[model samples]
Target chain A: MISIDWYLALSAILFCIGIVGVLIRKNAIVIFMCVELMLNAVNLSLVSFSSHYGNVDGQILVFFSLAIAAAEAVVGLAIIIAIFRNNFSVDITQINLLRW
Target chain B: MITYSFIFLAVLAVATALGLVISKNTVNSALFLVLNMVSLSGVYLLLQAQFLAIIQILVYAGAIMVLFLFVIMLLNIDEEESLFNKFRIKYFVAFLLGVGIFAQLIYSIGSFSDTLPVVSAQMAEAGTVEAIGDVLYTKYSLPFHIIAMLLTAAVNGALLVAQHKTKPLTEEND
Candidate 1:
């Protein structure tokens, strides 16, 4: 039987990858994808814990999290599109109009 | 069998995530994210989250990713520059910080001496759609309604934000 630690470890690794992606990548969409990866990693851990405890609460939380993620994606992509419309680019470094 | 499946799904998940990061083309990155989401759903199934497995594929892979791709195509963005062409000290520091956070998480997880409880029949039932609906409707009903409202707001907000506004004819004359 696989230990829950293994799943948790995997979650950590995926989350870290997301962090690195977010930090190093310049494209706004890629950064958004990295955030999604981090969210999925958390969902994986939550599901594992829910199974470990023989309870439904964690799964319920995951369900809510999934909904929120979808909503975030919709709004976030819309914002990115709006930015691209005005700026003609999605590179994060280039969209520094607010930088003083 | 389960262990082997877990290992395979875990490796696939990590690999696709890395692919999403490393690919230069935004379209390729989007495709990689789709693959990553699919692999994660496989992991969800391994964890006995049957309902979530389906939702992950449907909501994430099916709906959200399609939106990403649609925007990518609609925008027709150019491929990004090479990853390290403009590497700065700040990026290196960020990488180190990510590594530090990962190590901290791993160390904390390692320090836990107590093993997770074995999966019982009740745990298996908790993953079912019926069981989740039961709890979601009863104990978490308010949150459920809130989520519905949030979704509606998100849809309206996205439409409002993304709509193209025509420039005033007088402003164009200026």
Candidate 2:
């Protein structure tokens, strides 16, 4: 039988990678993708824990999280589009109007 | 059999995520994210979360990624110049933060000595659609309805944000 720790470890690794990507990537879209990666990693661990406990609650939570992720993606990408429209660039370094 | 499949899917997921980060082109990054999502669905299947696996594929790989690709193509964004050109200090700090968090997580996992319960037939049944549906409708019904409203709001918000504001004729004349 596979140990639950292994799944948890994988989740941690993926989550860290997502964090690194978000911090290092310059493009807003790529940063958004990294955020999705982080969400997926969380979902993986949630499902694993659900299976481990033999409870359906964790899976149900994953369902709601997935829905929320979809909603976030929609609004986030639209914001990215709006930013692109005004600035004509999606590079984070260049879109520093808010930076004092 | 399941162990080997789990390893493969886990490796694939990690590799694709790295690819998404490394790829300079926005479209390529989006494609890598698609691959990553697909591989994660496979992992979900191995974990016996059948419904979640399907939703991961449909909602993440299918819907969200399509929107990403559409925006990437529509915008025609230029490839990023380089990953670490201007932000050496930032990249180094980010790497250190990643390593620190990873070390903490691994330490926690290592210290956890309790053996997880073995998967049984009952556990398998817990992942089924009927089981989840029962719990979701009864215990989580309020959240479900809230999610419906959230989706509706998100759609309207997206439309409002993405809508191009046309200048009045007077402004154009000026």
Candidate 3:
């Protein structure tokens, strides 16, 4: 039997990589991608725990998370487009108009 | 066999995630992210979350990635720009902090290695499409409806916000 611990460890590593990516990446879109990665990591752990407990709640939660993530992608990408339209750049460092 | 599959998929996922983060071109990053999502869907299948696995591919790999690609092309981002913007001390400190957190997590999880209960077959089978559908429409029906409304609102709002601005051409008269 493949232990749940392996899945949990994988989830944790992926989450950390996402965190590091968020910290170091400069592009707004790449940052958004990192956020998605983090969300995926969470979903992995949720499914792992669901399987561990032998219940449907975790998978149900994953379903909801996936839906919400899609919605977020729509809104977030739209916002990114709007920003790009005005600024002519998607670099996070350069788009600091609100950095008072 | 399952263990090997898990390792392969996990490695694929992490590698693509790294590629997504480091690739200079926004389009390349988006492509790498798609790979990551597909690998994750495979992981979902291994976990016996069959419905979620399909949804992961359909919604995330299919829908969301296309959306990202559209945005990437629409923006027409220049690829000549440097991938890393700033290499300041603050970012280094943040990296160190992240590593610390990762170490702590591994240690904490490692300590409880033997305590996790083996999953029951009944619970494992509960991840089926039928099982999820029954529960979703019953116990989670209200939340599901609310989410549907929320998605509708989000679509409308995105359309409204992304609509092209039409400013009057003041210089045309000159």
Predicted model with the maximum lDDT: 2
Please identify which of the two predictions, 1 or 2, would achieve the higher lDDT against the true structure.
2
| List of chain B TM-scores, one per candidate | 0.89, 0.89, 0.87
Give the alpha carbon lDDT tens digit for every residue of A1-100 in model 2.
6788888898999999999999999899999999999999999889888887888888998999989999999999999999999898888888777865
TM-score of 1: 0.93
Which TM-score value belongs to model 2? 0.94
How close is each model in CA RMSD to the real structure? 3.3, 3.2, 4.0
- As for TM-score, the candidate ahead, 1 or 3, is 1
Candidate 2 lDDT tens digits, B1-174 = 988988898899899989988887888989999998898898888888899999999999999999899989899984767763278899899999999999998889767636666343467899888989998889899999999999999999999899898435564553
Give the poorly placed runs of model 2, Cα more than 4 Å off.
B118-120, B166-174
Please count the clashing residue pairs in each candidate, in the order shown. Answer: 0, 0, 1
Give chain A TM for each model in order.
0.97, 0.97, 0.96
True contacts kept of each: 0.77, 0.75, 0.74
lDDT of 3 by residue, A1-100 (tens): 6788888888888888888888888888888889999999989989988877889999999999999999999999999988888888888888777865
Best by DockQ: 2
**CAPRI rating of model 2:** medium
> TM-score for the first chain of model 3?
0.96
lDDT of each: 0.87, 0.88, 0.86
